[model samples]
Target chain A: MHTTDTETFEEQFAIEQRLVDSVVASFDSTTDPRLKELMQSLTRHLHAFIREVRLSEDEWSNAIAFLTAVGNITDDRRQEFILLSDVLGVSMQTIAVSNPAYEDATESTVFGPFFVEDAPEVTLGGDIAGGATGQPCWIEGTVTDTAGNPVPEARIEVWQNDEDGFYDVQYSDGRVSGRAHLFSDAHGRYRFWGMTPVPYPIPSDGPVGKMLAATNRSPMRVAHLHFMVTADGLRTLVTHIFVAGDPQLERGDSVFGVKDSLIKDFVEQPPGTPTPDGRHIGDRNWARCEFDIVLAPEQI
Target chain B: MHTTDTETFEEQFAIEQRLVDSVVASFDSTTDPRLKELMQSLTRHLHAFIREVRLSEDEWSNAIAFLTAVGNITDDRRQEFILLSDVLGVSMQTIAVSNPAYEDATESTVFGPFFVEDAPEVTLGGDIAGGATGQPCWIEGTVTDTAGNPVPEARIEVWQNDEDGFYDVQYSDGRVSGRAHLFSDAHGRYRFWGMTPVPYPIPSDGPVGKMLAATNRSPMRVAHLHFMVTADGLRTLVTHIFVAGDPQLERGDSVFGVKDSLIKDFVEQPPGTPTPDGRHIGDRNWARCEFDIVLAPEQI
Candidate 1:
């Protein structure tokens, strides 16, 4: 080494690299294999990101403060962390990695942070919108395997925000509406009465919303109904059927949950049309969308 | 694009990568260039890490929950997020990146979460260990520039955990001790009475503790005293001097803060040994350490 007072960027970078190596080596004592791999890789990638940006101390502190705010506002009803991941495309990416494209199986998307473990159950073709305010819509679909065989008894979970862009849980009052779980009938057909999903902003009174505003991005997601269908011996499908031609879809869903195949036409019908299941709807306009679900075999 | 139902890993990877690209491009409309760059780099690196590991949905949710806990517990007193960053070597790495190596000047370290602004001012050689229980120790240090010129009137801020391993702030009672600010004298020499720094553990009753336990890493930091020195036209030094031969140093500091050069001999004195300032001591043992700090120019 020449005796030069100047430390080149390469030399300076080498010092930082050694610190990274030490951190990586420190994790060598980790006993669990997966934990070891994860910690090591995470350290490496995280350091690489910092080094790439040469992140300033202020920036780092700001990030810590932002994340802390996100956590502080998060409770049983609000999860700003998941909202953060969704906007960054991480949630969708995880779904893509876990559920491979198999034989035209229904695409999977993020199971947003709002799902309650125990949703009210509804009978076949019964109204599932308990007390939410919205235009009553009919959602009909059949659960079937990739081979076109009926997946009888497949459990279907559906939830959507009301017309006011608020979930039932978002209200302070204890209310359980606009969410229900039902099992497929013997014919693999399922139907329910729910509100027509309208484009709505994700929780915007939190840090994620601040981030979006800072970046000049919108917080609204495309109109869509969330679905999670599970059957024995089949890969559970977590996806959404986007309302066709929604303006938000043209602008792109904030959560990146939209796939062209998942977009379906919600045909509007005049008032007093004959009900599919003889349920009366006097003088009220309704909408209908058919979303057929196909399950892939277990172990993608 | 070819007709291949096999869906090779390469193809799947490409699909995932496209999502990364979309997320990156989404920030194209960001008004601020720095924000744009930071957001895009973060997105790319984060997605790459996830794709590299094929991070499972469960793992993602777990990470979200862990971060939520970190945020929930972080208040004015405790900062779990910074602790998480410190243990992962991110804080130290950021310090290294921001402060480059200069002409044999004092090294810098993390400005740990415990520092309080406007610590009680102490006169030269005055005791700073007010209301804190510990063996009285004398700390003397000279401040100078790299050219060996004395830097008088330099502000030196110092703080450390008590012998009980808790900062004054950690106590429920409103008390300040073991911390003070003083200016170097005309000769650049300064001394203060404080507790002999001892080893301690970071707050570990939260998710970060569980993570350390799962990874088999000890949570104890080496014995050290924190110092921050600032003067006109000199870079502020946020650093620590380790008590030489501390066992935790051998085991490695939990925050990866121990540097060989920063370890100084904290000489123990038997009872009746006169302090540097000739303060009367009954029968209690004491320790002393000299830490002369050389500052780099402010522009570095």
Candidate 2:
């Protein structure tokens, strides 16, 4: 479309649309069909968004600068882009789209940036609160197939922040805490000792925090424990269990990760209750929760 | 909207929609209403795009990496983000949206990154080809208001790359060439001697270039001269005059800066025609072009 010296608004809009089409068509020679399709859709949607909002040059420049800052602050320990996606709910949306609902299977959530490979493994009923400070809590869960049959020897990786809301990586001293891997017993039952989960704010000292502040939004995730459960013939599940009564849950998770099934009651046990391993009861208070995970069949 | 253990596709979609709504609502407390509105619209559109495309985790990671590379390559001397926007047609779209159609006024284009402030000032008919090697060309233009009345004493800033297709900033020797500022004569006419405009590829040693190559798109912008004309009571015009009949014009410009009205014929004159100032027309051939710029009245 050729724009003349005197163009009506409609004509100019059409010219812009044609330009979008031209950009989309430029991807015709892309060798990867998926990339071609993605690029075309992205161009169309991005242009439409710009036109819809009448985005100004100053706003565009601001966005570029904001994105650049996000990239600049990124490093081995921090994934600001992923955090941006999480706060925007795009990560959860992608998870929902990629992992469709299966009958009685575990719902997946975002695999946050803190997962570490080769977490120290523990036996069933072992404590994973190494060098961590918090109220002791017993986490017992079962791993089973959709048919309710036991899936023995499944690997369960659990990670969370300490009571002070600091992850192991966040510590300047390079201390490891509040994260470990364990295998389910022959009865498909796994239990470990951990800290009582607490609501915590995501890192907010960077550009993303500035964005959240500008938008009057909080950068807090609900109290929760992250879990990645993997079995021999089932789909791997990365999910989280939220503390049922955490105020942040009602306020809505910043990452959009709170699902109804994933919320569990962290029952406070009185000091007189007997321990699961026949240990003597102590005056210290503790919490207990039981979560049963169901895995979907792996595609052939 | 909470998701249960059993969710139909529609139910899951509703959940995702609710997540989007929550995010949008989170911006309700934004102090700046315009920013709040923009954030809401942007969040909705961006979430919708992700849902429509069903973007996968791997694809999302790829996008993050690509944007990081683009940001990493950007610096004072180079702006890869702007290049990315230009290639995607966003910069042009923003210009079109920002500058609406004005009656008989010069249409604006992108102010490319090569523009340097405080360029050497020259007389109405001075040569701006400083320490540059190229076939000589004469550019003459008149500045007029919308009613076709000449506006005298207008400031005109002209800049372009040398015949080698490299802007002054792109050189390593720290030499300045092919750019200058001049004022129009009493008759609102201005003329200058410089290299013949030639099509040139944008810097392709960055991530934006990789994107272009991957998408099978060219990095060549159409041959053109950059101009910024400003007068006392008239709106400033940032635009380009494309050399007509250039092959790249038909192929589409990399920056989407070309417009039908901005195209002008650069007529070739074999070594015989007298120069504009009656300078000796030696054995060297030259070209000539006339561009008339019209400025709009500045709004109060």
Candidate 3:
């Protein structure tokens, strides 16, 4: 390559690439190896992306402004960054990479930022809806090891949105509903009364929504219920059972979280139909779903 | 490759990789070709980074919180995201990729977020340090095309921190100094009185500062004077003339904006030395520097 320092754009670009090296090397002093690796890899990949696109200065300015808007709109009531991550498929990708599929363990999904540690404890087969407004639904499942052995007394925490597509936590009224924890029985069986999962947009009134609109992508997510299950000697599982036959599945879930294995039939019952435990109900429709969870042995 | 679904972590990992493909394909409906390219490339690069790092869930949460904090502290007066980009070297890299070095045209560096429009215009050899406190200095520069012809009347805009290391826009005190625009004379030469450059730490007290402290990096920027020059039928220049012997150059600049070609000597002068334009000064030292700018022909 015959060239002066910047005789051609390629030569000049080479100088630019070397700066990435300098940046990656800057992380050498990081005491933690993982942090160092993360920073360096991030530098490499980010630079590669910029180099690939020859990202215009205007584009870069727009990105910075976009992120600033995202941060400005975020507060205790709303986490726009999470919503941003979800829309970008970063949240789901992170979920995918972190939770390696182990022997028949229920495949994990986004542990959405809505999980509350102090959810009221409910007994098996009891109502977990706690007055959140939605169609009455019956849910039952078995918690078992990969070997099909019953895992008794397994802690199962479930949370979901109401028919209005808002989590109970989203309310400012200090109300808690549609969320609770219970333990599986000796036969590894558990049942609960909760509202049916409803398809909802993931907090789209923020910058992420603007991005989706700009890219011509839908902000809708298919209906699904969140579950976090833990038992002794088994890896904890965070997953969801999405409603089958939801039309959004064919299009795309905003978070890219829907998987074929996670989809289950949400059987709908006509108004005045008999409840599982014979609970009385006026004329109103309901749904029922079963999700059998398989847990992998704890690695440690 | 013989395997059942989720049989092994690797096999399952393959499924995770497929999600990246889907995310990229989702951009197929994007009507704008450039927007589609940027989004798809972004998705691929982002997913590649996540997979490469196998970033933990906790780390992901921390990152979201970090960005959120960064955004929260930003106001019209402060741009934490720009500082974040500076520390991460993204700003300089963008400058590199966008402004392909051409001819002897002053190599453009970071177009720092400090430039303001409607800067008061001044005549040649006039004082630009209006109401700003700093050691006096004289700056003279020639504007010429790459072909060595004078670019007479080229518009020269300059801005820099005062001795207190703050830009006029950074204060709500209703003051402006150390920044003004002037035009080159018929001889393509310009001169003005201003302050000597001073090194300063970027705004801290926020998440970007926390990140730098955690990684053992300094937030200090080397002393420099920012310059932006433009002329008709020529590419505009945004650059800085760094103090040649500033110690921070050996350590590191937070923004990685320094280039060897951009450094110039700010020679000190005795108080009573003959002023360049026959101006009177009390017992105070001054510094002087010369910059001859070369502009490339405007591409359009």
Candidate 4:
């Protein structure tokens, strides 16, 4: 006759706590209470998530494979895994959860996968289109405090896709780059000529793509422009302003970037005299869009 | 004046869903139901976990660092990351949550990190323990059916630490290099001479070690014998039997391998007649323990 003892799921979870306690007892000199709390909380949640899922061998192996692929696809230029997070809404969710805005402050959105340092500084009213192929538009925007006073000299880092649906940094020619760092003028007003953004597809050639493919999904993003607005005594706001009438607007993006308050209509403007680009603007259909941003109280 | 739109968390979650939907909808051929389900569920849980944590920039960076360290420590002979999982209970939990045992079956335990594939096979009654460093004992056990009939020719892989707490596989030449593979005799009895296991410390020179140190935990494991038991018409069982009175028993192991049913007492055995190892009389202090295994039925 065989004798046996059965251990229940609760017993197993309790066993986990004991083991964790033992492990935690070994720390030497980490006086950071916040770090300790973070580690403990992370361990608890990670353990609980494992128990709740009842994860299996094949499943664990596949997760390892997915992570391996995420690393493999990451390089200097692109971060496919971060893009994965963005598309999955983790990035935006994190932004929202950590940076809740004060009433009347500009809301934050995803800092998409393409922001870079060293974008060439451009003067006020300098066109950012860089001869890129896209719909010609005059974009004017203001930065203001919650009290409606103009906050002059606010920095705006503007970027968007070209008519061909690609960033200048994504190409070899280094021309037609869509990024311009400009300061708000004395009246908190800024205007620059640019080509209207076209809908673009997030890169789909990695494990994130395989994951999306396995789920029967698309990779298209809606028309939008990324903005980073910063000023003294206020927290920086990372956000995107999307075009109003893009088909993908109602459909939304694969990256959770659309906000009703951030969308603006683009109205056609009568043509004017051509600038120095040797192209006469009066003959072409021109468009105009205006948006104003309000800053939030700084956290630190 | 700023225009405002009130957005609910549900609305945010819906927008997140639409984003993932767009990304997933472009897939051409995803016929595997399991893969399809896994992809979507992984995305959903991952999204939820991020929101639940409200992960911040530094936190995210640290997470990346932790995973990178995990990958860096992984190698062919030593999978530190797998050891990390074993310590964290993920490995055992993965197996256990999926493999519920029926009545009369032996329980499973963590497959510790020290398994080596090149064990030398020996016949029944062989001196698997090649040295006198450990307390000499003959391990005699039977493999039997749930009805108590002997299971002939069953394969058993036995490995343990010497009295000084070191495995043969762990050192190039340690006395009582406790490792042996033996088969059951015609009557289903198997015997091997080996020393009594002593408590041993797990390696503490990696990220897992760092984590343990930070948590204020010990690195010692309870005395135990590892076994891989198998027979025809029965599913394979990988398990360990722990020494009953080891000090590490009270606090449990950092790896959480102590199961009540798998704990056994190691009693002092009386000497027998002259054995093959050249001892004239049976006057030496020896240890004795026994373990009988029951296996799950095969599918066909």
Return the top candidate by DockQ: 1
Instruction: Give the lDDT of residue B295 in candidate 4.
Output: 69
Residues A1-300, candidate 2, lDDT per residue (tens digit)?
245555676777887887788888888888888888888888887888788888877898798788778878877667788888888877888888777778788889988767777789988877778888877889898999988999899999999998898889887787778899999989898998887899988889999899988887888999999999999989889999889889887787778888899999999888878778765537887889999999989861
Residues A189-217 of candidate 1 have per-residue lDDT tens digits of 99999888899999888889999999998
Better of 1 and 2 by TM-score: 1
Writing each residue's lDDT as its tens digit, candidate 3 over A88-107 gives 78988888877776656788
Task: Please name the candidate that would achieve the greatest TM-score relative to the true structure.
Answer: 1
The residue-by-residue lDDT of candidate 2 on B211-240, one tens digit each, is: 888878889999998999989999889899
Off by over 4 Å in 3: A1-9, A169-175, A185-188, A231-233, B1-10, B117-120, B169-175
Residue A171, model 4, lDDT: 78
The regions of model 4 sitting more than 4 angstroms off are A1-53, A75-80, A117-120, A123-140, A152-155, A158-182, A190-195, A250-252, A266-289, B1-54, B72-84, B112-140, B144-209, B217-233, B265-289, B298-300
Tens-digit lDDT string for candidate 4 (B1-300):
322445545655565555456434433245776665554555555555555565775576566556556556555445666567766666666666655554566777777777666577877766666663677765667887666778888888888776766666556453334677888888887877766777887767887787767666677888888888889987677888888888889866767777788898877756764554454434677777888777666541
Which digits, one per residue and each the tens of the lDDT, describe model 4 over residues A1-300? 222444554555566555455434433234666566655555555555555666766686576556656655566566665787776676766676666646677878888778777777888778887667777877887899877889899999988888888887677675647888999999999887787777998877788777767666667888888889999987788988788888998765777777678888877666664443344575777777887898887772
Indicate the residue-level lDDT of A236 in model 2: 89
Q: Which stretches of candidate 1 lie over 4 Å from their true place?
A: A1-6, B1-7
Q: For candidate 1, lDDT tens digit of each residue in B93-161?
A: 999898877877899998887889989999999988888888888899899999899999999999999
* Residue B53 lDDT (model 1): 85
Which residue pairs does candidate 3 place in steric collision? none
Error of 2 at B300 (Å): 10
CA error at residue B5 for candidate 4, angstroms: 16
* Prediction 2 TM-score vs. true: 0.88
